[model samples]
Target chain A: MGITDETLKRRLDGFRKRMRDKEIDMALLVEPDNQYYVSGFRAISYSRPIICLVYLNSLQFILPELEKDHASQSARTDELYVYHEIACHRGKDTQFHRPLEHLLDRQPASSTIGVEVDTLPAALYCMLHERNFIVKDMGPDLMEMRMKKDQEEIHWIKQAGVLSDLALESSLHHVQPGISELELDSFGDKKLLEAASQQFPDQLIGFADWTCSGITRSFMPHLASSTRKLEKNDVVVHSRQVWVNHYRAENERTFLIGRPSNEQKYCLELAIEAQAQAMQVVKPGVCAKDIDLAAYHVFEKHGYGEHVQHRTGHGLGLTEHEEPYLRFDNELQLEEGMVYTIEPGIYVPGVGGFRHSDTVIVTNNGFESVTQYPRSLEDMIL
Target chain B: MGITDETLKRRLDGFRKRMRDKEIDMALLVEPDNQYYVSGFRAISYSRPIICLVYLNSLQFILPELEKDHASQSARTDELYVYHEIACHRGKDTQFHRPLEHLLDRQPASSTIGVEVDTLPAALYCMLHERNFIVKDMGPDLMEMRMKKDQEEIHWIKQAGVLSDLALESSLHHVQPGISELELDSFGDKKLLEAASQQFPDQLIGFADWTCSGITRSFMPHLASSTRKLEKNDVVVHSRQVWVNHYRAENERTFLIGRPSNEQKYCLELAIEAQAQAMQVVKPGVCAKDIDLAAYHVFEKHGYGEHVQHRTGHGLGLTEHEEPYLRFDNELQLEEGMVYTIEPGIYVPGVGGFRHSDTVIVTNNGFESVTQYPRSLEDMIL
Candidate 1:
């Protein structure tokens, strides 16, 4: 968690450039990840509204009265405001409307505000509209700014990757025939967590919950753990995840309960090969979607094209999924300092599901696998 | 675990009663807890938008195509709409703007719609307003309805209580002289999770993360677990939480390590007495604020009034903190079936913080404590 004020300053400078291009005088940020990116402060905004107003040269955080102490401890911003101290009717401040208006009044009255419309509540939007402030969506400019990872973010992601590997190794050790998917998941979760206190000791980095889907249940990409016990030839799809101060990394694998059937082997090998082939072309100046095409072409050549379910991969950073999603038609180009998960999956109803994912970072020359956990079929046999 | 259609039916009927009283033709639910309370469906809506539309006699669910199978399994509604097709950009649907408009088109264009305006994003609200629908806030109507806990929900809360006690007991055993706060949190976390698969073999209940805030850190109630190791006179505030399906419950304790100073013992006793006094008045027909006053009176009598930080407690159910926040100015009356935490605290930064919380349901005569984890000063000594 080596987040520094300098890093926050760098991100703020990037936002200012984007704001200048978008002609937004001020930004009303509500998204947790977005706020964390602009300011070093990150607190819960799920139960209540916590906003950050970003001007070209200043950062202001507005939060509930209860969280004032937390903001003071974590927020790098100097200007802070709390609601409920102002006008209230029945001791309830509805929508933080008055507080938001009061903050907006501090700036130029006609400031063109850039709001995260996708996440900000509509009632709050109406309040801003009622005040006659020109509003615009903080879309491409904001998303593009977050697309590239910083050295600090990459460092956290790498640390998370180490934890991910530990979790995966624990899952590999527990994938027995009689064990339930949930039982195996707990083994991995506890295994890594048990090591955390001994290793990091004081660090509060959190282990993301994970699950394994045994048998045909593995065909579903995001299957929850089941009470169903693993059987021989069952394809067990399991994943390990960890977040170091909100920067996350994932290492997913498709393992066999016992000996793999020929069909299962075929699916697993193709997935592995497809991932290898897809990643071979990953580097700066590459189209994000073309990376997906590389994997799809492999599946199609093997006559299991319809079995491809999700995209080749998704960008990974502070949030689990970020911009430059490796979907088929995304025209965004991959850039250096961008980190992504390169996963190619194929699922057949009766046979089984096969997929392997690794976290990789685009480098100056090529791509570096940050989470290089083994994805080989023979190595994954339980 | 025995969630059934009857539970959903009962909740829907209750919503119908409120909708009729409020003259709202239909309701759009977005808050995860609110949607889960009404429909059996519970899926991630973090990165994507998943909406629930409740009409007079029907329930409709709209979600991303990736969650179609999940919606089918968990949602009681038959009118499910998935945005994207199995393919990529060719079938990609942007926001639910079109899907929402289509759903609204089935009703009167000017139909009066009740919305969770506090949580609904501004972008989605604009779509509804743009469609010429009469929009109204579902605040008072919704909060009042959710305030009361159903028997099934109460059952889940009680079950969560059992797990909480287990976690507290484990933490009590692990609070040694030199263990770091995070190390202690992990000890309890692992101990509880280690037994999850065996006890509830079919359940996928996830535990909410908790930590031990040792010594001076305890004064900051929500302080993240640090590297600080336990000392002879440290006061450790630790909480345990479990979510059964979507219902959540918490049990928190302030433990005295090895030995306690006179100040520590005094603060601990005052906090315990304050909570006892607060719960003594928690019955039907009592003002929510009065319960807070009961605690305040004790703290004031003890000359520790300024030490009190947050509200006495908040209503608990699907989410951690809910309606009927026990603040000094809240005028809402307590009613039977309303469940809440009764926690009173004294935080002296230089010394330590002391707080004990219990989840209880208002009964006909008074209240019954659901989370009866031992918070006695003698039992807390490690």
Candidate 2:
């Protein structure tokens, strides 16, 4: 659980460089991603705010009293401040601002503190100003620093990829007729946990809510699960992606419930082929859109162009979805260690759709496919 | 899903009355909760920014092209506008400012727009002035408008409670040794999908990750699933609640894996009795902290006050953890129709912990308990 001191020092150097380029004294990270990136301390709370004070030389954390033990054990901080409600002894009405106020009181006076203006509340900004910290808004400078994945991140993502493949492998056996889509989804969830039980010890979102387009799957993303039970010749879709430390990896596959029709088989074949075609061009220095085009042209040649909804795929790393998406309009230049998904799907209303995607990492020469699931239509039968 | 015009008109009237008191016009709501509260659109793609352009007489929505169809279908708006990313394709990544800029351009010139300053980003605020709209920071005017739930909101929340209970009921049967905590948590997730299907699809921090106590359990409020095998004497805690359309129905239960020791039974009994005692005093005009003290006093009487760590609970209408917490410092007087959770726990470190909590609605006389799970320790069996 402890990151090497080298990793810590390198990130501080990166942040220091970014802050200097942006002409800021200190970067105040409020968003969960920035906090995790800088301090290596991730609170278990989903949406509860954690204020991370990062100066060039040192770092500090202010956490709720309940989470003090957690922060002390997890966060790489020079100092830790704990705040509690103290309501058990005091009968007077007090606002929930005491802990934050106490932190502000101790802040360096008139310091040019660069805040994540988007995440910091106006009230908190006012509170800081009242305490003599001149808050300056630092834009996406810190986020841009996180755009590229390092060695450890790439390793963790590779581990996540192995876990995703295991999930797909386990769930494939349960994709028979009479089983609900949710049951299939939960089955995949079970598989993901089984794979990561040792690595993460406690990992959630291993198998997230699965979205399927049984009959009307022509290019629509984010389909809600339906009560329509799997039947003979039903086209089934399942995605097993894990989100950890604000990073995400999504890999999807389409299957036949019992016996698929010729059209369904053709669609699945073309989709898989297109994704493979996209995978061939994912080398360092290639434009992200060209790889997207590599897949889009295949789908267009097969007359499924209009039906191919959604982008080819998205960058698969921190934040289930982030910058450098695989789309026609995206101008991002793919770099080594950049990980992304190349999913090409075709949906037709009331009929069904076919999708095949995998997470891939760009290598020096070409790329490495993180997903090892079978892509052939004949191989994906219940 | 369509609300009556009378109800809409009444809320609008109340909003106007509050606006007049604050001396602001054209309240601009960008946060999802406030947007849903005013415009009634539940967003799917959290990628696109959706804003509620509320004026004196009517409300309008500004959304990205991909969200137009879904947002238009659900949003209670008189007008809708869609912005693009330089092309006709949907969900294409452009700067998020493009759509936000377009919305400000369409607004009437020289009108005072009340911005939710706490939620609106500074970059977005800079964009507003560039588009000729005069922006004024409005404090808690919109929050005050949403604090009191209407009859319809109460109905939806109660339905959420029923669905949450069904999930807990289905999940309890799967609680046994050998199954990883993630699998146990997945049972609750599957049950939730079965109960409300689409209406209640979001995650309620329960299950999947925090099912078993190990290293993760030590990190209180763990949202991820643990790999720890449920042993004969282990205690499993579920802290996740159910959230439907942002309205929260908080509930938690601790289950005994197989046989329980005398201290374990004592912990469970104390937590339930304390929660019951707190629930007994909920009604109109009681300060929120008094209920917290009721639970605190019981734990103190049992000489387990130090172990009864976390705050009693908090207001649970929107966001699983919201404002007006049942803590020692809160002095907000409870009103009828206000719903919140009263979760009190006794943690014994590596020895495991016990908690019994439920969502309660303050009625005219006493209160209506929304969570119907059995509070008895004997009911939870392997």
Classified by CAPRI criteria, candidate 1 counts as: acceptable
Please give the C-alpha DockQ score of model 2.
Answer: 0.33
The per-prediction CA RMSD against the true structure, in angstroms, equals: 2.9, 4.1
For every prediction, compared with the true complex, DockQ reads 0.39, 0.33
Q: Per-residue lDDT tens digits of candidate 2, residues A1-382?
A: 3356688779888888777766666666777767877777776653345678877778887666666666776678998766565455354223336655665666666767788776676556656656677667764666556667888778777777787788788778777766566566666776676656656753433445565636743234554444445666778778778654445677788887676777777888888899889888888888878888888888888887766655677775766665567877778898888888888776765557778778888888998888888888678766
Best by DockQ: 1
DockQ metric, candidate 1: 0.39
**Model 2 misses residue A102 by how many Å?**
5.0
Ten-residue region with minimum lDDT total, candidate 1 chain B: B85-94
**For residues A83-153, what per-residue lDDT tens digits would candidate 1 score against the true structure?**
54211223645345666777776767777999888888787788788778889999556678888988888
Q: Which stretches of candidate 1 lie over 4 Å from their true place?
A: A83-98, A223-233, B85-98, B104-107, B226-232
TM-score of chain B of each: 0.93, 0.86
Docking class of 2: acceptable
